[model samples]
Target: MKATIERATLLKSLGHVQSVVERRNTIPILSNVLIDASADGTIRLMATDLDLQIVENVQAQVEVAGATTVSAHTLFDIARKLPEGSQVRIEAADGKMLVQAGRARFNLQTLPRDDFPVIAEGPLPTSFELPATALVQIIDKTRFAISTEETRYYLNGIFLHVAEDPAPVLKAAATDGHRLARVTVARPDGAEGMPDIIIPRKCIAELRKLLDEVDGSVHIDLSPSKIRFDLGNAVLTSKLIDGTFPDYSRVIPTGNDKLLKIDPRSFEEGVDRVATIATEKTRAVKMAVEKDKITLSVTSPENGTAAEEVPGDYSSAPIEIGFNARYLLDILGQIEGDSVEVHLADAAAPTLIREGEKATALYVLMPMRV
Candidate 1:
């Protein structure tokens, strides 16, 4: 449509909404962005890939109000390369668009706006709001565990549900048969007694991208078949996976007696160096704890072996455990403390890890039979 918008403001919203449009699509218009300008100095942008859709509102100077569909990536590229704070002038006529700002000028071809798809509307009955920071934390902690195995469609998304704990809570969990990660946060106001929502992996990734610059809260609304995230200027909608997530509570170890408290960095670095010699298929690093020190080692006939020691404040019975080096590194990345406590019932059982001062979040790892 015909409108004038500030270069920086237009780029920000376009950057968020344009990501939803895939470069290649079965339908031609699906690769383009729908731009609608109103007489009230506001512009609406829409993009979709049939299943997922995004709608965003941006500020603009409306001249001749109308609508058009153009290449989202191409427009974004042109706007980004233009001078900062320059006023961009856009006009649509005769199936062509003329873009001008400062000394630069671009003429882009346009597609019919009617061909662009809008995500179907759902009568979402359950709605709630939560702090954007809290949602971001939950995603960061558990997204690493989401299964990429497409054959098992049920395990492809984060399981968001009401946790059965002393305090009412909501949790998100993911596992790929190798390692499991679950994060629980107290339910916020308006979110009281909300039904569980299992969001797909792509949806979580898209929603997380929008939250990076947001400071206020995000409004969450869900229908039985769809989920929508309202992040002020932008909105993300996705179809939910019609399958049940496996019960994660049962997998968490209930009784772990021996505890190993060691500096998180020291432990992480030791495991990282030793795992270099281990086989790529099984990057297993062995942990041997005795008296008051924890020794990490990996032996590979092809590349020799590596061994190192990390001091700990533990005098409990010694234990030896083998784990995937990558899994341990994932959990360590989420840890925010100098020391981390590892709980073990036995070398053959699952290992539980928590911050010395327990984080609002916790994780348990199923040990490998090394």
Candidate 2:
């Protein structure tokens, strides 16, 4: 295969697909990206790591119509370091791929295109079109809470399903024993009766990258075992986790009636300052809420105690709760509004957090004994 592609165009396309290739591979062909050139002025680049695959198409000047494979990381690095506006000419000859741009030239070993594994496409039973912005909002607000524990494989991904209560909505939720995040958006067209799916953590990350570059609609196709995303010039497919996510609705609190409204910035700053004295292992911060003020304090056996008082609007009886400082900061960071509303039952119950009056996103954090 031979083609000439602009450095910037090739670099961007490679950046999108190369990330799927693993750095170390037992099968040599798995490290290479399949490049196919067509006479109609386009080049297709594909890479995979058994479970996940990404394919991207970019405009190029094609001199020969054929296919070849080369190391994905090496090719991406070469394209990135080339002169900005220079044209990159690539050709396969004598079991090697030659890359040339301006005064620099390099030859990389090539693998037979036939040896590359291709993920088979099957009939997708459900399909829908969703705005890129909506998908980004759901993933960003919940991905942080996904469990990293390997033993409980079911909680390692985001649970996506539809809610029909007050109104129809698409929801995404994630939890790790310590905290949970849930977000909802208006249901998209053609999403009715869609089966619930658990999208793996890696898939969520790759889809997020693709959405960051485009502002159009993303086509989603799903079946019982697999999921696919069509992002205009790029396509991503992955195997769905083979386990059922727990019923997250039960984990969310419904009877936490005590309310505390405070400026998010002030609460975040106070938590940050007092957390310095917390021990590295526990990193626990104690919060005491009274009529008009919330005091955050951290005490460590080796380190001195630190406390900060922040003004808040709370009329409930005095309550003291202890929580992991890092977990509190993560939930606070996702709040977009100036004020945060925290619902509490008591020191032993899980606290519910939300941004102002928005019901689209909510967080539940478990308390730790101080």
Candidate 3:
């Protein structure tokens, strides 16, 4: 393979594809990226770890049309350190790949292209396009709630499906047993009959990073077992989690009578200050809500006790609830509005939170015993 590409362009493309390559791999080919130079003036780079794959295309000057495999991280590092605007020349012959730019030159070992595995592309029946901004919002609001516990594999990803609340809407939800977050947006065209799927945690993270620089709409093709995202010059394909997600609707409380509206900034600050004295294991903060103020307090056997009062608009009966400080801060950070609405049932029941009474995004926290 022989091709010439700009240093910046090559580095950007490598950054997108090389992240999928595992640092330590039992299989030799899995650690390398397949670089295919075509006579049509473009080079395609592909890297995968069996479950997830990323393919990126960059414009380059192709001298000889061929394909070779080289260490993805090594090539990325070489391109990253190259001076700005330097032209990178890559040529592979005799099981060796020569990389040269400016005053730097490195000979990297090449593996046979035939050894690289290509994930099979099956027919994907459902197709839809979502605005980049909407996709970003969906991921940002719910991804933090995704469970890291490997035993409950189904909860290790965001649950994406279409919900019909009089009108069809696309919803993304994640839960880690202690907290649940749900966000919804208007469903895109051709998504009415889409099957519910759990997008794995790693795939969600990689896709989120790729979306940072993207604008316009992203094309998505989905099946029961696999999903493919078509970013303008890059394509990502990932396998969906096979397990079934729990029925999250049942967990959301619908009969909470008390309403408390408070400034998210003040509430967050109070929680942070009070939790400073909380036990390291629980990190729990107790909230005592009254007519017009909420008292946040924490007591630790080793560290003393702390308390603070935050103003609120609560007229219902007083209630005391205990919650994980980190989880409370996470949900508060997602609140886009100035005021956050807190719905309380009791100290033992789950509490609901939202930006407003009719907001599309909602959060539920299971209270802890103080």
Candidate 4:
């Protein structure tokens, strides 16, 4: 394989695909990226970890139509260090690949392209195109709640499905037992009968990065077991978690009537300051809500105590609740509006949070004893 590509363009494409390659691999080919140069003036860079794969195509001057495999990290590092505006020449022969730019040169061993494992995408029947902004909003607002526990593999991703909250809406939700995040957007044209699927955490994270550089919309194709995302020149295919997500609707409380509205920025700051004195394990903070103010306090045997009063609008009967300070800050960070609404039934029941009264994003956090 031989091709010539700009340093910046090559580096960016390599950066996208190489992230799928594992640093430590039992199979040598899994550590390398497949470089395919076509006569039509483009080069394809593909990398995979058996479960997830990313293929990126970049415009280049192709001199030969051939394919070869080379260390993904090594090529990325070389391309990254090349000077700006330099032309990169890549050629493979005699089981080695040569990379040259200006005065720097390096020869790296190549693996046979046939040895690379390809995750077969059987048939993705469910396909839809959604605006990139809507997709980004769904991921950014909920991914923080994805679980990392290995045993509950089903909870390690975001649950995506269409919902009928009086009308059809596309929803994405994630939870780690302690906290839950759910965001919804108007249902798109082609997503009416789509099946519910759990998108793994790692895939959500990697896909999020790609979406940052993309505009317009993204094409998504999926089956019960796999999903494929087409973002212009880049395509990402990932295996879905083969497990059932819990009935999240049952966990979302609907009878919480007490309402307290507070400035999100002030509440966030107060929670952060008092959390410094909270225990390292629990990170608990106590909130004593009155008619006009909410007092946040924390106590730790090793770190002493701290307290701060955040002004809020509350007219219901007074209630005291304890919560994990870190979780409170996380939900607060996602509130984009000026005011944050906290609906409470009591200290033991789960607390519901949202950005004012009409926000599409909803967060539920379970309280912890202080």
Which candidate should be chosen as best, given lDDT against the real structure? Answer: 3
- Per model, how many backbone clashes are there? 0, 0, 0, 0
Q: Candidate 2 lDDT, tens digit per residue, 103-209?
A: 99999999889898988868888899988998898999999999999999999999999879678988899999899999988888888898888999998999999
- The C-alpha stretches of model 1 lying farther than 4 A from their native spots are 356-358
TM-score of each: 0.95, 0.98, 0.98, 0.98
Q: Is candidate 2 or candidate 4 better by lDDT?
A: 4
> Which should have the higher TM-score, number 2 or number 4?
4
lDDT of 1 by residue, 1-370 (tens): 6789999988988898788889877777887889999999889988887778889899888988999998999999998999998999999888899999988999989998877777786687778888999999999999998889999888888988775577877878888877788887887656666666678888888889989978988998887678888999888889888888887778788688788888888888888888888999888888888878988888877888899988887878888889999999998888888878888888778788888534776778877766
Model 2: residues with Cα > 4 Å off, grouped in runs: none
In model 3, the runs with Cα more than 4 Å from the true position are none
Give me candidate 1's TM-score against the actual structure: 0.95
For candidate 3, lDDT tens digit of each residue in 56-152?
Answer: 8999999999999999999999998999999999999999999999889999999999999988869889999999898899899999999999999
Candidate with more favorable, higher TM-score: 1 or 2: 2
- The residue-by-residue lDDT of candidate 4 on 198-275, one tens digit each, is 999889988999999988999999999999999999999999999999998898999999999999999999999999
lDDT-best of 2 and 3: 3
